[model samples]
Target: MILIESEFPIDWVISPLPEEEGILGNIFFISRDYMQFIEGLVKKYKPDFVVEDKGMRSNEEILSDEDEFTAIFKRGGISYRMVDIPEYALNYISSPILNKKALIKKFSGEIEEYKRRGQVHYNDPHFQQLVMWYEYLKEDLKAQEEELRYKIRESWMMMGILELAKKQQKKELTAFFICDKRNFDGIVFLANELDITSEIINIKKVAKELEEKNSVEEVIKSSVLEIMPIKMKKKEKIDKILYFFDTDEYCSPFDTNMGYDAGFDVVIPYCKMTAERVAKLIQDAMFSRKVGAPTVFFVGGSDVEESERIAQEVLKSMVPPFEYPIIIDPRGAHTTASAIVAKTLEIAKKHGIKDLSNKKVVCLGGTGPVGEIAAIIASKLNANVFITSRREEYVKDLAKSLTIKAGKKAKKIEGVAANSDEDYYEIIKDADIIWSVGKAGIQMVSKEIMNKLPKNKIVVDINLVPPYGVEGIEPNFHDEEFYPGIYGIGALDIGRLKYKVESTLFNKASMTKGKTILDYNVAFEIATEVLFGEIIKISI
Candidate 1:
């Protein structure tokens, strides 16, 4: 039966017996003092839809409103707009439109009385006084037509109501007076999160066009969602990652170790797969988790750009606050980038620098994952960071992406082309620190450029492969000063910390019970926390 959670006390529309499928509903109206406990009612009846009779709303508004619905259904596993029962949608003719034309006709008596009073009330008890009383009375009749004239237009709420009714097998939908918008909105919001099956319908327009209701029960004798499917009650009480990689290597043993070291009990690496392939696998794994079990996803590959796109697809598969968390650290970009930033801070601290404010830091080779992530982290640290590339277009694109990803730091970051020795000299004129996280074997900041930098500046190189990431920094150099007074960290220096940072994040995720989006920023946070002895969690 339909459950009308009316705002005002309702007197109309009696509920037909359970046997009568049509016009069957229990009314909770009249002094809607009980409206506050509507959630209790929703829990009690689990109604098809809480039919709110009187309210005005738009589709966009319904989509934007989610807080109330979430608050109402505190727990998960709620299916709203549960099924596509288009049969009711097609069959039902609106009672409002059918009775509208005849309504004005019924008021003919009062209308005539109103006219008669206009003519003869010239001297009742008092002519003007009688006229004023009748005029006020005329307003009631006017309001009647005004209310029914528009007919019933289906807002997003109404369409969802019928579908939900059908899904719950509460096919009896007879509606009322004030649809507080909250009930309608809340139901829709909860349903969306729970993945309710619904189809859009214009019931109001149908009521306007169709003059008569279909008395037939159902011509198709079919069903939509008669019963909700059985769900897994047990949340997989463990954290897992179907760590997908694009390369044939499946995954790096080092990366897999990082996950286990962080907090995951198991890390299953599947290599050489496309986004489409991995998306399906990911969905399967995420769905298998028990109710309270937490899962974290990790996406890593040499192709940082493509990995980010894959991460987007992974996100599309998740139901927020319900699904497991996902982290995109493609090609160790986020990890290494975070480590680079932390190392920079350490160097700054050593030099007695208070903060990076107004400090100029030049990031060489800003097009790679490490470069972009480094730039983002630096910007967050309040550094005046300059990200350079061989081409202006790549710099511009990275600049735009960084601006959005890094927020205010994006403003402090400017993209420049540092292809030539002259470009390097001009860009690094005011540089206090330098980070060279260019592509493997690419000579980004040559000795010519390094020689031009200030004597006391800090420089870091993150390219571990042959040809190194920077000009003067050795691969094994930790925090060593080879360039006069310039302190620097080499590839191994950042690599060791990158491993630690990633491990710390994983461990943090393991300990966390709720969803935690572990990214470069989170990595940097854990890194800094580890440095200050604030982080106590240690994964074996």
Candidate 2:
């Protein structure tokens, strides 16, 4: 958890005498004069323990209410400790203070004495000033104690709400209480005032507007701005990275909320993101964590170009030799596409699906994006390949350009007309294997065509629509032998291969130094490794 303490109020600082344990959570106090505000904040931000800075005061200026500075963790069974803030962490987010040396000397001496002897007598002169501060706040002290109790109860409720979020499947609910920064001066006073409590409240109205399911930017624009501090750019910090592999489809903000609900110290979303805007949005999500580590990113979106750019930008932002963990391709398209075809070739010999020596493999919709790549992989595997497109001219042009790029003989490349199922069948009938790579809804193979396949024919479909590319085929179809005793592969089986390859590549990607672009070959190699059982099972 990345802890953010915008400012710490000096006046509210009090050296609590340990009844059991010192406060142990992080504190982000912002004002000194408003005791009421501090009182409320202490409850609202009721940390595990606090590293409090008790202020210097004359004997007459000290608060005398022992109850005002009550320690109720014992009664509630909550252990907390308050210690002096470390200078390194303090420099980044702490408030300015006066007479630092004197304060350090005073507190350090007390800490040393407390550590040296288990018991420090209250009657000792060293404890006199500490006793005076407690006495000064004693008049209003009882009310403060009540406020602390209320906060502990509220913290328990907050934890419960988080638990409920985890139990609920597929929905994300994030809560934030926004208030005016001007009112910050009266934070301590506000804590004392009951009326101000409700003003800074839950995110009901904002959540309602977002529930309408508009875009993320719209919700962010409509809800709150106080949380984002302009001019607070000390530097764009990249804390750490989290990876999600082969499960990008189900990876959404709601999924991220689930992680937060589960009490992850810091949950950074980093899978299935495919857009550039998502990269920037992840940068913003870094602000939410507030206890351990620095601000990190949550990178997930559904646009490929954007995801690529984000990968680039994130690498650039990281320190030299970047070496940050980034997880992409969990959705399984870019990585899986290359992997499936490559793996097929690796196992082709064992399956008796051989003879790439001048044999042609027709890729239906070959000019289409995925088909084009499938053709390239087949060509690289030493198969003479013919690519077809609805528009014959486009197929011709693609083959011509690819011939040069691949450094293969241009004569091995061939193009033909294929605008519909009939044209598709005519072009693929003589080929050894038929690879279907088209839009989800388009059906290319019929039952009659299946019965007509050669005895040793091999067919692979990468479509995941309602009706499988070949009728009677299930998405997760698995059998020792496929349709009519001819070898066949379904979409989900390929999807599993895709997932395994994706997870492995993402794990390896975490080690990349900077500006690494995962290309077709990277996917091809990973898929080959997965087919050979060189990689572990893919994660969801």
Candidate 3:
């Protein structure tokens, strides 16, 4: 789990014992004001152990930018001992004030700077008044800084002492709440996020209780946040996914929502993501996790090759033992291909064709992403696959590339040109499955060609626009025996399963362990399992 503590609102102040001697007017817990911002970061970043400490050093104001000061951790990198702050637990408790001498020594420069910028002339009474005001503010800031430092030291020592106590007594950090203010919404929100009982104990009460406790063990056992994340459940994983879509537009709500529906606890979508950006994102996601992390990656967009390149970069970013599964579905092609091939198998089985091994499958528009993937999956079923294009050279090149990608299944598939009517007739003459993967409204296989083609065969047209990709099958048909003895599955039929298949794969990405890539073959397996195989529950 990665924890990203958002920017601390450094303006929040609490006046405790206003007339108290030595210490400053109010305790400054500048980091505690952003309850909502912190919560949002916690959810979005999915951090395991949050570090909301404002160490006494004023590092947030000086060493880092406001955004940079807000902590961002990759998964499994939550041990933030580098901060070296007191364990800030009970509602923004800071240190006691410094002496007047220390305040002057600490902020003399600041006081002078204020005097230099004052409104009146140096000799004027108003200038004197302005100088006095600067002195007052400087002293106040110095005192607050010292007091915050004291609390920080106390917290650090308390944490060390308490951890030793826990080891000695075997007590859990979950057993305590060390807070100063009970009714503050910010306090309550933090308390709840930490999964503690919001008992509303103020820091003052907590401090008093600490003083009364005789043993160091007793003091730490009762402090929340300060005790460190004790006994975090090693099991029971919550999955998160980073989805990078490379397009001018950020991302469609459809896919992102689908990720959530598929069981991801949080789905962070990034748009217009480049290969370089994806590399960094991959590094962050993978490096943030330890063993059995539920975080994963999803790559998608309209540009097929670019998305593929980014996905490849993501895969390459992971070294052995520290990697997450990635799914590549450019323009919904992977899921679409899975559905198209799965439907063909379904239709074949209905006609008493149990095995697809002997089937002759021909895919029109073979050069396209959808067609190529469909050809690959169908070939995996041992079907004799042939991809056709108007250009013989293009068909051959697509077939070669698809062949390389499909590996052993390459032997079962080939490509040919089907530019003319005679070519289409000859191609579909012995085809058991004819898929029109051409662009929408461009009819490849017409009614006449279907009439001449062999019967008891399946024809699938995944084009919603008219003139349909395939000549005879209706664009709106889900599954109608539009042509006798030949079952035609339309675009909508494949589309429905396409959505289901993608969600199923996402669920698999979250749940599946070890090294696994969810692509067309995996998608097909999941789709078939959902429809016909053992009753696997698919959420969407």
Top candidate on lDDT is 3
Q: Name the TM-score of candidate 2.
A: 0.44
Q: Which lDDT tens digits does candidate 1 get at residues 40-156?
A: 545654533333442222234334444354234334244432111133432253344335434545455554676786754545655555455556545654564333322223234
Off by over 4 Å in 3: 1-239, 247-252, 272-276, 288-293, 475-479, 534-540
* lDDT comparing candidate 3 with the true structure: 0.64
**TM-score for predicted model 1 compared with the true structure:** 0.52
Q: Tell me the spans in candidate 1 whose CA falls farther than 4 Å from its real position.
A: 1-249, 272-279, 320-322, 408-410, 534-540
Q: Across residues 1-540, which tens digit of lDDT does each residue of candidate 2 receive?
A: 111232332332323334354353333233232333334545665533322222222323223333333243333333322222233533432222223434545665675677598766767675666555444444344444334323332333234334433554534322222223322223323332322221232111113345564788887677542322222222323433443321255566543553344333345544544444444544443334332333323344444435556656665554433234444332344565575575456545566665355667777666655665566666666677887777778779888766554454323567777766677667767777767776787776777776666555566777888666665566665432566555666788887776665555544554444335555567777776666645322211
Pitting candidate 1 against candidate 2, the one with the higher lDDT is 1
In candidate 1, how many Å is residue 111 off? 99
TM-score of each: 0.52, 0.44, 0.54
Per-model root-mean-square deviation over C-alphas: 21.4, 21.3, 21.9
The residue ranges of model 2 lying beyond 4 angstroms of the native Cα positions read 1-238, 242-332, 354-357, 407-413, 483-485, 533-540
> Candidate 1, 381: how far from true, in Å?
1.9
Model 2: lDDT equals 0.49
Tell me which of candidates 2 and 3 scores higher on lDDT: 3
Q: Give the Cα lDDT of each candidate.
A: 0.60, 0.49, 0.64
lDDT of 3 at 71: 46
